[model samples]
Target: MSATRTFLMELHCEEIPARFLTPLWENFVHLLEDKLEAWFPTGDSANYRKNAIDNSTGLYSPRKLAWRLVGLPAVQPDQTETQVGPPQRMCVGEDGKPTIQGLKFAEKWGMDFSAVRFEQPAGKKEPCAVVTLTKQGRPTVDLLAEALPGLIAGLHVPKAMRWGNSEFEFVRPIRNILCLFGDQVVPITVDGVTATNTTWGHRLYHREHPAPVVIATPGVYESALETAGVAVSVEARRTRIAQQLETLAAEVKGRVVADAELLDTLAEIVEFPKIVRGDFPADFLELPKEVLVTSLREHQKSFCIEGPDGALLPCFLTAANRTDDPAGFVKAGNEWVLKARLYDARFFFAEDRKHPLSDRLEKLMALTFQRELGSYHDKTGRVVALVKHFASRMSDDTDHIDRALEAARMAKCDLRTLMVGEFPELQGIMGGEYLRHEGAHEEVWMAVKEHYRPVGADDAIPGTPLGCLLSLCDKLDTVAGCFAVGLIPSGSKDPLALRRAGQGIVRILWERGWAFPPADLIAAALRVVGAKATKPTAETNEALMDFFRDRVAYQLELAGYAGSVRRSALAAGWEDLVDLKARCEALSAFAEDTRFASLAQSAKRIGNILKDEAPSTDFDDSLLAQPVEKVLAACLMKLELAPDQASLLHALANLAGPLEAFFNAVMVKCEDPALRAARLSLLHRLRQAFLRVADFSLWQ
Candidate 1:
């Protein structure tokens, strides 16, 4: 074996979209790292694998991605080979010479006849014959030549494109492939482009002598690229951009308001950090903050700045590809583009409010929610009904219920407005704003605004009670509508994001501790669905409840509940998520006690014993022949359950000793018929007490 060293690969292509750059680079590196470990587990890889595979930074910028792996063996280690063939008795005839079978085997294996030797068996009388084939391991560079391109192909991109006359498809057009193994080029062709050790820097940023810089070794890649004016590290680039934006924002007594996703996208779109401040008309600030921020950030790839008091300022920051912007050309261009966008937004805001949001409700009939689920108008009616049901669960106040129903009635009206038609993300916000413009109540419009509060796990839930009720109703109506039409989410495929809605439901219920039965709400929602549904509602109710059960289990699992506890709670049947969670908590806590181990074992034993015996709920004390049977029966009859899980668990805790003794003394399968029936009856009673919590045997 030869010594190990580092390998490098850099792929430069046509400019990749900001959204595709990071994921493409990450997917390629992940697949390539797995290939590296599996192909070359060298002697030094044992100590440095963590740093090499997981911790190594992936260097990617616009149009380029690269990786430098250390401690990679030059070639695979040699391995021994053994092949077993026919028995020795069959290989040689009675004359003790090679038979026709032996010659045929030798010919088939492409080996000399004399090389097929006989070997004796350790425990058998006859000797078995074997043949060994020495398979030579290939060079690491050669293996990489075969594996790397396929690994690159395995990267997950939404779509691939064809460029020029090449048959190969990739996210973008390939311009260069830089592959180096210990300073030597590992040559391979991908779509007519051959890899070399030479790489190019930023096309126009460098002031150096030439841009085609040669990386002498993999260890000095960053330094080499630095000379070519390319910042290869994404972290360094992001920090540089963030620091610049902060400095620029502080000049105006404001802070940069950029999300993580926007920053990441900006980080991928530029090779060198260059941020310029631009301004728009102050009248644009009159529009909703979301409209201004979305207009700037979504299309222009810029950042919004906010004053200390939370009001958005007139200035925005846009990243540039080049640092030297003479005469402020980039700034002037960005300012002009933002001015036009704000003018359009100002127009949309004006035209949308001319008739008020209420008038848009009649127009929603032309817009269908689904082909068979009727229009958004019909959905609004069902959502109003569901809101009434959910609001009654928490508060009996007439005002609260009426406000929630009124909020639901106006929920989907914004979809028909002009502002929402232009900026779809401002649906709820525009609705609330329009309602406030009409002098509606705060509770009504606030609920309308926040009904979609939590679109994901990271998002915030509704703050108001009316908002919470309306959100639940809206999500449940969508889920019921989809399920009624057979649009159920399958494995890894949720086209309608039903999983998010379901997760949001479980999160809200579990966090708020609202006392509502999930089954009853699901049935009620289905009733609303059944009335307007095109298909029969016979199976949709049961199917949706089952989906809810699976999601509840998933939600609890994610909350760090032990699988055993969840199973135990689910064993009782899932009707209410809050109650199921409470029972699981009580049972999990009880399992930690010292007395629980023996009782659980006894509980498990009771189930095993009753497996073959016919169950009888009727306990005949007249047939009792033992003292333990009478004691067990007496304790079970006195067993009383309270409304709370803790109280029930406490009652269950008392019977553990008596039940343990009954199993210790009384043989359930006695010879006499009456004694056997009596003992089985006693065990049956004990089993019923445990089932109040869970199928305890399942926990064991």
Candidate 2:
């Protein structure tokens, strides 16, 4: 039986950038789990399966990433192996004792000459000397000493830099490493820092509380750090920050509003969180909510507070590292920073509204959107043209069409605005705000505001048709522009976010119930932008269609459509996403029937039979030499398939009996060339019918 012990390790570094801290810890812990499990798998699979996290777990704060494990064995189990040497005929040489070669083998394995026994063979009547060697289990501390350093060295970040002339590079320079098991310090070194049992608590807290926190035992490390004013539980620290923010919001009659991403950033930036609710002038609330929130969260790392009536409050909450802001000095300082920020917001807001969006159009030409694809000015014109073309395919309402075109023209003009320049995230929102202030049409304002909807995977689609049209138009033009410059996304690199644009296009049309396929519009967009493009129009048009098809398959896959169904839809061709998706779903359901498998099998057989031949459907009926052939040929002519699934399957099922009989009775490759051609032609007619919905060969 192996003795189990708890283990602890802390990588204390110079304040790691808050963004890199979480990922660094996560990547290191994942590597640690795999390496530890491989080298030391718990034979007790039952317990290992029940409580896996206890085997290895991690926590992180601004300057530290650490882990504590329970149930780690004290040492590896003892192992024994045998090595064979010279035969016994030579060993039992003259005196019925070991020979020189056997004695040499005993010395090689550190065993006595008498202990080196000889193994006798049954058939050959020969014997050989064998040395049985026992390997003692290594101490867990020694094993850890070797592993932990390599693990630390292996940890990487997005932007790594070597420090102090050392070849090792990381997000930041390592100041100290603490690795402990029970009460013993594990010997390890990383980037010139040696491991120790002693660790310092919160940096500032150490100044007043000056004693070093000795980790007497691995199990008590976290609690000891807590006593020294440092938090070790990443989740608990995040929760405390949230709870304190909530308590502060109640006193001010407001609610703390923050995205999960912002909260995560805040949690990693502080070890001991102290919430400070500071107020600014109420007049600054007149600025857009996004401007106020962006200024606070992005700049100060503070969360915006909204009052009970859903209005922005003058106050915001900041999570500071210090526990005590005695005499309100810190609170006053925070208020000063926010006031200066909101003052800038107030200036950009007032100055930008002074001019209509049209006045900024010429200014857009000066700033390049994409060097190869021309300017945002050029993009605006293309989007307008594409939106009008898409609107014609969508609805008969010219009012909405005209509104969509106008919105597309003014959409990116806000990129040149002073307010949007300072707060780039407010590009579309500011465009809508400015257009509304200038008494633009309500539809145009709505279109501008919602044009960037469904920004991410789960983001909502536009609520209005005009919004949908404008959004689709904008994304399609970008995709076209990228393809025009021969910048199609390959592998994981999508610099222009073409995948998101493709996904956004699919989501809008599918959600808005637009059955029009995007292929034609994509082709039209190519014509709009592909004239002077470095790449050929035909080449990019093909790539763009393939891009949308992939996004379409991805969307259906997320919707739980089977791969076979997806393959079938892809085979049929992707003209309309809505129509293609419906076909996929119908094929998936039709595939569930037991009889459908035979039909699928026959379809596959038909494909194999006509692999090289271009069998025509116009084969004469007089060539039908068999009754099954006549029945199938007659059925093919009267076969009328509706777009709906049940109708199409019902029609296809009508020919299944004749198809089965035809395959079972007829010999397709008859000696006569004309007869073989006729039979292949009949199979061609059958496949064409299934091709209307899907290439049922995919079902096979």
Candidate 3:
């Protein structure tokens, strides 16, 4: 082992996008450290010397990025080998002659049958043979060379590009590769680039200097790049950009909005960051606030500054490649870019307002959301119907429901608009904006915006009652329609994002305290589906119901309900969404009580014994000849037949006494034909009565 010291490294390339730089560099550093640890564990910090691998692993801000891994181990550990066969007890039994189980075990381990040796004592009850074993570990050098290539292969671009005759993929063309172990070159090659002890720095500034920069250790990597006019560390670059922005904003008596996303983008865009503050025309501030901000950030990659009260100022701050000219050049260039983007935005906004929201919806009817499923217009109609149905079930406000229906009717209208067609993510948001401009009712306008609530798991649900209803109805129609068309989501592949829609439904239900049975909502949706469905079959409907049921079970399980509780409640036949939840709650409570388990166990046992016998239609009291039968009948008579809460508890309580006594005295499977039939009939009566509470068989 040699003394540890800092090493410097670099990789140069053609222009690469700013966004690709950060992730690429991070991945490279992670892979390098992981490979180092796998090769040498104990000497990770102590024995290894500082080293430089790639200065910018893949950090390319429309140019290049590399990595610098310091403190790498010089050599790997010595190898050890071991091998073992079967367990001792299997080889020999009492008075052993090599047991059959032992022979099979030996065959599985690929051991020779002749190697077995049994030991026995005169007074011993059993004897066993121990199998010999050896173990071996692979040489570290071979592992390092083999594993590093695959780890490097795992590096990827958000989007890849093709170049020349090679089949390799990267964000841009791979021009070179650099690999080193302390001062020695690792002698590895990938994607037509060979690893070396040399790297390049600041391609544009050192255009004539193409010689590879030799770095001996990692500590020198960043300092060397700084001297060569490059910021090798992405974090260092980000910090510099943030600090510069803050300082620039203070001078102007305003604060930068400090959008994390914008900061990240800026960090990757420059290796040597130089913040340049520029101002746009005050007249352009007349544009919509969103338009103004989007123009600056999207086109110029600039951060917007705001006054102390939180209003956008006319000025913007941007990062440049370096402080080359320091004043006129960067500002002039950024302002030019902002002006072009804002000009286009202003043009589009004025042109789009010429047509009203309703007029746009009329044109949107021609666009199809799915080929066989129907158009956006068709979906809107289903949503309207679902919203009405949803509203009918609620005891809230009729006026709000009407407004929600109107909003749903007009929700997809923005799909036909020029502005929304360009920015699809702003679909529902634009609909609300357009409706407000048209002077529609406030409730109607708000519903249009809220209808698309919960686009993702973490997104907010509609806050208002009407908005909540609209969101649920819209999402349900999407899920039901997708299921109807046989376009159901599969593992990690929701082509239509139907699972997201289903999640939105669950979220809305939970948020609004609308504890309707998921099964009932699914059934209602299926009913709507049934009417609209041209193809009909019991099998298809069953498949659709099964899909919804699985999602329901998944949602409940994810919410932390036990499997047995879900089965128990579902077995009780709850179709109302709210009712099913209540049943699950009741069952969960009952499950915790010790007596309930015994009762459930008893029900399960009786269900198993009478499994072969068909349920009795008639409970003839004449069968009460047996003491158990007489007692069970009398108890059933005393319990009130309440189907809901009070009655459910009463019925469950009544069965407990008879159930216990029946199990104690009666043997249902009697040898005598007449007596067995009578006893079987009594058990069937109990099963039928018990089913009124829950189907115990489902618990199994």
Candidate 4:
């Protein structure tokens, strides 16, 4: 008989950061589903069938995320799959009908022609026969036993530890686990929590009187929990927090400053979200709004409220641990933290303004960006030089470029200032403010702030010419300096953020419509700082060049080029990144056309014969006595006259007939040495015809 089952699980922690709950919940749900699928194919399946059965599962996270799976079939249906045989022609005698071969096929499967079916084999239109094999499936109980424990065990956090004699590691110490098959416990345990039929409600809200929840069916388990006063859906928690914040903000004639990620993180941490309003002294509002807000968000984890005109308000809303007495307790706690954070920010900002940004440039000499790399000031020199070269080469506003260069020269100057030293994220922002106050041009001030444009993937690219130039130069220095210092990124290790820097360069150049090649930029920047670089071995330097080539290739590939096209372009060489991109794009354009398949096949065949190795220059054309060879040579000669794409493609088309005729008439690897060399040379010439496109063999 088919029946349903459910699993309810929860862990009581000692104040787990709300931020970690949602991700952990997602991880657990995914792991459980994957395990269940691997075992039964569908959670609804049971031990009663032999075919894959389908199932449904639900996951919810409020303070705690829970998954309920229901409507699972008891077993898989009977297996009835077919094993195909060779074509009927192979099974029939000269009579063109069933022979000994056909008899053997039928006898082997213990079936007659009635159970057998005939169809065309895949990739061929010729008819063939298949024997169906039918077998019953096993019970689902065995599948669940094998899958569940290990799947549950794999649900762990960023860091884990060993507990008790068991080896399972979870984010927190698990207290109880509930696994049910219909109304019966599945009989499982993790850490020390044995599977039960009950789970707890809201921690503090139900503190006075806890309720015992019954885990009957999948639906019953969740409904039972809801009756006990706990919300286990993360979306619900987030909505509550946002709604409460809006309501509280409206009361004070202001709007809640919406920050999704912050709200999301807060929602995951606590079960019962309570928006508590807090206020600071009006005097602190005198500081710049950015400083005030950063302190609130970064340090206090509070949302700063703003008036209708976008002016800073004294009030901030924070998510509290408990709903009771939140107004009194939360206000005091949050206000205290904000006051301390604002004081530090104000002190650093005031102290930093005492000196002009230009005067602090020398101080970067002592700041170490990395252990192997030299001081920050040394980096500034590299950046400044690169920016000047970029300015000269690219068509940008000269005044803006010069201002940008000046700004780049002093961009890292603020790193030495007490403000930037204390708050690293405020580097460019602080530099802009200080530069403007120091009597620098407005362009220079703007460029200083905009140089680090697009700090993340979704962030904006530089718009103004000076902004673009500085962004390009700054990223180039980061890539070059890291490579120079032997700090190249590898699989999963990009501490230097070389990947992000490369991405930034691609975005800036593409957005600004600059036709400059990134490979040329890398080479030029390398030349300027090559002497300062810790010289790597020839092999390592080659690897670094290959790394840059790969970065450019990946960006191009993501822009929608075929893998074959990308490989062909990259295989040609990595002399110029922009040219490589053009090559890939051009090849990709051809690859999409229906005519391309034939061209690709022809190129692939030539590539297969010649490989990448070029034929010996010593070609004895006299040995090519066949008319086909003579015709092919004539075609090659014509192709060499005008080697553009259309001409090359035309030449290849002309050789198609001659090349096919030659392959059919003459042996390529001849016994005679002179003849073989000529044949090889002919094939090599054919392969070279498409070399302007790509080496198709490299793609496969």
TM-score of each: 0.88, 0.82, 0.67, 0.71
Look at candidate 2 and tell me the lDDT of residue 186: 93
Among all windows of 10 consecutive residues in model 2, the one with the lowest summed lDDT is 45-54
- The TM-score measured for candidate 4 stands at 0.71
lDDT of 3 by residue, 415-439 (tens): 8876666566667777887788789
> Which rank order by lDDT, best down to worst?
2, 1, 4, 3
lDDT (Cα, tens digit) per residue for candidate 2, span 1-700: 6677777899887888887877787788777777666556546522442243455654778788888777777777666778887787776677776778777888888889888887864544567887788787688788888888888878878889988779998887887778888788999888888888888898787888787788888878889888777887878888998999899998888888857778887788888888888989999988878889999987798988898888888898888787778889878998998899888889998999887888988888998878888888888888888888878777789887788888988999898888888888888988998898899999999899889987888788888778888898888888888888889899999978889989998888777768767677677888788565888777887898788878887888777887777887778877777777677777777766776667778888888888888887777779779998898888887564455665786778676788899999999989988888888877887788788778877775
Higher-TM-score candidate among 2 and 4?
2
CA displacement after TM-score superposition, residue 36 of candidate 2 (Å):
3.6
lDDT of model 2, residue 166: 99
How many residue pairs in model 4 have overlapping backbones?
Answer: 23
The TM-score measured for candidate 1 stands at 0.88
| Model 4 per-residue lDDT tens digits across residues 1-700 | 4543444455544444555665666676667656555445432353322221223222344434455555444454455667787778777768766777777888788888666667886776798887879777554444555655676677667676566786778655666666655555666666666767777666664667666566665566655665565556666667899999999999999997767778877776666677888898888887666667767777877898999999889999888756555348677877888888888888888888877777877777777866555778877888888888877776467875677678788777877877666667777877877787778888787788778887877778865678778888888877876787677888999987888887888777655667777566767777766666785545445655677666666676566777777777677664555555556656655665555555556566666777655687457777898887887788777877754655555555555566667767887777987888888887786566556656655754
Over 4 Å off, model 2: 1-6, 37-58, 77-137, 161-168, 243-254, 307-309, 323-327, 395-398, 562-564, 587-606, 613-643, 646-700
Window of ten residues with lowest summed lDDT in model 1: 41-50
Q: How accurate is candidate 1 locally (lDDT)?
A: 0.80
Q: With candidate 3 superimposed using the best TM-score fit, by how many Å does residue 280's alpha carbon deviate from the native?
A: 2.9
